[model samples]
Target: MKVFLTSLFLACFLLIIAPPLMAVVDLYEFDTESQRQRYHALIEVLRCPKCQNQNLAGSDSPVAEDLRRELHQMLLEGKTDREIKTFMVDRYGEFVLYKPRFQKSTVVLWGLPLVLLVLGLGIVAYIVRGRQSTNTRKMSLDELSSSEQDQLKSLLKTSSEETETPP
Candidate 1:
């Protein structure tokens, strides 16, 4: 029983550390090399609307399969890459591409992360520098006027007198 448990644990460990699985099947049903290349390239660039993080070529989701089929049909119709992408963007919003287009709507998508990163780093640096200055503030003797010094001493004397006099 102990040996079986040890073997099962070893198997689980090996499975945990296994390399990423690539179930790459021939997706483009084409006799010519150029058609296949174009088909592959289009699929690779076209993002899966359902699984927005993965391209149609890399994702095995049902929507990815449908998107791939649609891309194949577009290729057969001799649509250029741009036309296909534009059709997709029109059908589903600009989120269909892995790289957002540099148009007005997506400008925030591209710039937001960078802006947040810069702002976050600026705040962190400010805080770290703030923490490093333990004794940065100091009063110079010349900065305090004699009248002000006398006022401070009088205030202190008044506080002590009040304490001793008990109200």
Candidate 2:
């Protein structure tokens, strides 16, 4: 029991400490602190092409590593942020950027949610209007033909009489 407890404790300790050590460390050298900060910020925002949902900094895919290296090289070459973004966009399309630029191509991506919301509201309004119209158009007993009203009254009288008299 003591040996088992020791092994469990050791396993727990390793599990707690291992994740921080397993994180990717970008080792590229930057000439200034600002450059390093810029690189870090860019990697955190840039989406990994291969991982789809993960940012370049958090992804372990080969494509993420390549993009990181390219970004580092661009920074070292003194390329402006816009120039680097344009380069990545030219190569990988707007999907590479986490915050995609507002352009003709991306209007659908930005506008789709609003459009869907409007459509949903329209459908709800239509259903509500249909229900209201149906309720308003309901036929009253007074509006029924004299023969139909007499037949309904006779049916109700027979049903009530049958219920009042036990079999």
Q: Model 2: residues >4 Å from true position, as ranges?
A: 1-24, 27-37, 73-79, 99-112, 141-151, 164-167
lDDT of 2 by residue, 1-167 (tens): 99999999999999999998998776998899999999999998889988959999889899999999999999999999999999999999888999999899889999999999999999999999999999999999999999999999999999999999977
Clash pairs, candidate 1, are none
Q: How many residue pairs clash in each candidate?
A: 0, 0
lDDT of each: 0.83, 0.94
Weakest 10 consecutive residues, lDDT, candidate 1? 19-28
- Evaluated with lDDT, which candidate comes out highest? 2
Candidate 1: misplaced stretches above 4 Å?
A: 1-26, 111-167
TM-scores vs. true structure, each candidate: 0.51, 0.64
Model 2 clashing residue pairs (backbone): none
Q: How many angstroms is residue 8 displaced in model 2 relative to the true structure, after the best TM-score fit? A: 12
